[model samples]
Target: MTKIARRTEKLTEALRRAGVRITRQRAALLSVLAEAEDHPEAIELHRRAEAVVPGISLSTVYRSLTELENQGVILRHQFDGTPARFEHTETRHHDHMIDVDTGEVVEFASERIEALQAEIAEALGYEIVHHRFELYVRKKDGL
Candidate 1:
């Protein structure tokens, strides 16, 4: 199934669904994003895209990312004070645990936590239409 997805769902197709026009530069940016596992900020994403599409500019990357986000093809997260990072929307839904010391992001999901959040929201006399959870963490000594 994953292999089929990799073969079928190019980022450009996603952009089209979001009403974005496809260009060579845009395709290159999407290619980089499709291969990325970790969240990457604009500069980092541009750097990676450069390898595939020479002469890609920083401004173009920013524009492409913004378009992708607006199209609902990508999701953004800001960890600590760092520049925002982006991930593809089709990936599994989960919360992020950032190792602030290393800037590493670990994705995790918990049914119990989800339930608790819903309960808390209801207790507060509101329902959760949408939410984001991110936990900043540090490694313990002699782990």
Candidate 2:
């Protein structure tokens, strides 16, 4: 199967495990979610899903997203001053940089930053369990 198909199947299975029936509309939403690269808000997701299969309500989108999130198949990011956005949990560990002006999110991973966080946690007599790091940035004037 293609990557998107595999991801959709995985999402479908997750929702099924969460006791959510996979209706045509919900399946469309799952397919859209699986194909998403950038974090998208619920309304954006609803719009996309509606294009694939009309008549999908925004409230249904929200409920399906909540169910997917609860099933640990997706992650929601509430960046400063923006509506909550979501991405599938299959992505590798990474931090985010949110463009303050454009509301764009960029993902990056750094071993140095991870190690530094671990060191800081150890110095405070604690072990790093889970953490989220985000940076708000704007484009340089000339760049």
lDDT of 1 by residue, 18-90 (tens): 6777777777777778778888889999998898889888988888788778867788898879889998787
Span of 10 residues, lowest total lDDT, candidate 1: 1-10
lDDT for each candidate structure: 0.82, 0.94
Leading candidate by TM-score: 2
For candidate 1, the lDDT comes to 0.82
Q: List the residue pairs that clash in candidate 2.
A: none
Worst 10 residues of 2 by lDDT: 14-23
Q: Judge candidate 2 at residue 103 and give its lDDT.
A: 92
Best candidate according to lDDT:
2
- Give candidate 1's TM-score: 0.87
- Candidate 2 versus the native: TM-score? 0.97
Kindly state the number of residue pairs that clash in model 1.
0
Clashing residue pairs, candidate 1? Answer: none
Off by over 4 Å in 2: none
For residues 4-98, could you state the per-residue lDDT of candidate 2 as single tens digits? Answer: 99889999998899888888999899999999999999999999999999999998899989988998989999999789999989889999999
